[model samples]
Target: MDARDRDGPDRDGREADFTWGQARDFANQLIQAHSGKHLTDLEIKVLQGSWQNHTYEAMAEQYTYGAGYLNRDVGNALWKKLSQALGEKVSKTNFREALRRAWWQQGRSVPSVPPSVPPSVRPSVLPMTPPLPAVPLAETPFAEGPVAPQSPFYVVRSQVEDLGLRSLLKPGALVRVKAPSLMGKTSFLYYLLQGVQLQGYATIYLDLGSIDRDILTDLGKLLRWLCARVSRQLKIPNRLEEFWDSDIFGSNDNCTAYFEEYLLQEVPQPVVLGLDNVDRLFPHGAVVEDFFGLLRSWHERARISTLWQQLRLVLMHSTDVYIPLDYNQSPFNTGVPIELVEFSPDQIQALALLHHCSLDRPALAQLMAAIGGHPYLVRRALYELGTGSQTLGQLLATAATETGIYGAHLRRQWLLLQQNPALWQALIQVVQGTEPVSLSPLTLYKLHSMGLIHRHNNRVMPRCTVYRDYFRSMHRADSP
Candidate 1:
């Protein structure tokens, strides 16, 4: 008997034979076959949540886990594993369709055809493709937070990573990774920390961006928080009281003594401390100088003190260091500076292929022309295209519109600009002007850090065609 005889399309004339329970079972089977292990409880929650179109934040609220841990750490690995098992690209947004196609391919159910259609003209549930080699669709996991160290989607900039690792291994090393927002600076640091760990070093990765504003403003609280976090990562007992004395020592001195007497001494191997989004502290005028100056002191001491040499620092930030400090007290100028640049065309092609998007040279060129090899933007485009949801032409056609794949990101940039009239006007000039526009140094830095415009020498232009087109259209619409 034909599958259509048992299960037919719903009233809407679309197939309704597939269900979420069936999807879960199919996923379980594929995952078990691939990993020889069953899904965890949290994994099931994510699977169910994704099936219901629930965002990671929603899942976290419902299930009581950190959204970052669920999305970046768990969701990233889960989708990649599922993609590998299914031999097709899978993500939270597209997994439903992917599973439906897979189920239909397994002869589970045929899509119900309309009786009006001719007997010989019935369509298959999905288009058939050639039996090609399985792509590492897992490598191209969803581009959330920082790209996981295990992801193949990470494109290494030329020799920059090697320089970072080399610098990280040196005694008293200070490696600074600076890039505009979404340029993969954090992802690079993730990989760098992994590499350092493999070399018998104790590694601690912290994202200062997530620190609370209240703690940020208080020097004493911030120092204690930093020490407590480091101790936790190192699995050592927190002894801040024994080392900290407000009347006897300044916050910086207390922080130093805690590290020198406690953290540095507890670990047998050298320690590589990775501080991501360190610029988060920049707004706290009182805390920023003392904290950074302390780091500078540590780096200087490392030159002569073996105990201090055991500590290596990796600071990653998305902005220029505009805060003033005495020349000898600043840590920014003395390190191996690794500034991440936008992905090159070849690099973008490599990442696209990882996402199973075998875009041809011309198609790749078209994408580059629109987005200019921005890592996050390029990955997002490939992800959408790989899902078989839209053609390259369709994506590019809707690229600058609010309904397109990049709509949320574009809207976020717009909202941020709208909050600051000066930044808003500055961006307008860059987007509308035929030649590169000159702006104040601070204004230029802010725009560049926001990833809205590219800086060439001292002049600026809209980062890419997408920004140029979207902002230009918005400017026109907002005008008389």
Candidate 2:
């Protein structure tokens, strides 16, 4: 009979052709063969979840565990283990077929399709640690408040991970990180800096925000500060007098000369210069344009200049570059572009665990729905909950109010909305409904840049539940 021959009695003499036991047995065999090791307790549960084709969320509900981890983290780890074991690429979506192709060699090939779960019984045999019990609000995890930026609590998610261990040998390699305020732009840059250093590269960090306004007012003055900072960090003596030539060389050439002639020679390794808060330059028109243009000139130099090739750049900013820069002249347009986004539910749970919070899976989901995984907000919740400052329920309820934890931050944004009634009314559309509302492109850009909304295709929605609830409350109380 053909493989498709149908309507046969099952092992239990039922009409069904497949059973969970068959799928379980096949999956276990593949795991044992390809994983090079017996499946751990959690790994088996993960395999079962994948075999059943249950959404991580559905499986989490079944097993009472973190959906995010059970979905991707565990899946990724399992696939990685399989890939190593079988010397092949394996992922959750196709691991079964990959195994089937191998199993065919033994002449005991199981069916390619997974067995269907009967409507009646789905066993949740996953053995894992139960969620941490919520602590009292008074025992807040972060009694001192926000962890220092780039603290150990920073949890990296799979989606936002673009700066992997890839070689940066490409000359003039540039990376631009753009996101709205409080989106972890600074934190991401620090991580990149650390990665490069581990790769035996030297890094110089320049926070343009720290440059005095007076220095930025003059091109020569700012370049001098730049040279001084880089040289200082490099431990190279500042040879300012040796390179100064006001009439003979322009500021751009002068700065490049300082790096080429006097500074870089002291260093024997490639330099990764990480620039933070580039938005500070937008307001200073001539200064920003000329300075950015000078930076671009150096990037262009790498094609022919070995000295410049030794230099790499990482730029971080909080908004769209409304500065009207030319393509070749804007550093934002070139190099690998990455945008840090809000954390996913799984990443949030991982971070919560790092903070020593025992928040359950449902609580984690509810938290994400409320705050949308705003890096700062999610961390704040975990920190507070750990310190026993507020229960998860309490945090959600008081989130949008004037006296709430985010009161000051919400008030500042509310003021901006009040100043622009059009933006206020546009937000009203999003707040009043579950579906996203359409807005003009520039309008959407401006609103999203302010971290006020998130765009879905041509429509706009509040960035998170916190934003919607807070704004709604503010409209009733403050009318902003």
Per-residue lDDT of model 1, residues 412-473, tens digit only: 78877786787788889899999998999878877886778888888988889999999999
lDDT, candidates in the order shown: 0.77, 0.67
| Predicted structure 2: lDDT | 0.67
* Model 1 poorest ten-residue lDDT run: 125-134
Instruction: Choose the strongest candidate by TM-score.
Output: 2
> For residues 1-480, could you state the per-residue lDDT of candidate 2 as single tens digits?
332222222323322333333333334444544543344445656766665555778878886779887867777887887676546898766665554444333323222223475524433221111112233444434523323323435444433443522324345677777887667777777766765675578898899878788987888999989998998898878788789898898898899999887776777888888889887787677888788888787788888988888888877887644323332333446677787778766556546655666655567668888888788777777887766678888888898887878887788787767667876787777888878888877667668877878878889888888889888876777544
TM-scores for all candidates? Answer: 0.68, 0.69
Stretches of candidate 1 exceeding 4 Å from the true structure: 1-140, 320-331, 440-442, 456-458
> How far does residue 230 in candidate 1 sit from its true spot (Å)?
1.4
Candidate 2 residue spans exceeding 4 A from truth: 1-151, 164-169, 320-332, 478-480
Q: Candidate 1: deviation at residue 307, Å?
A: 1.4
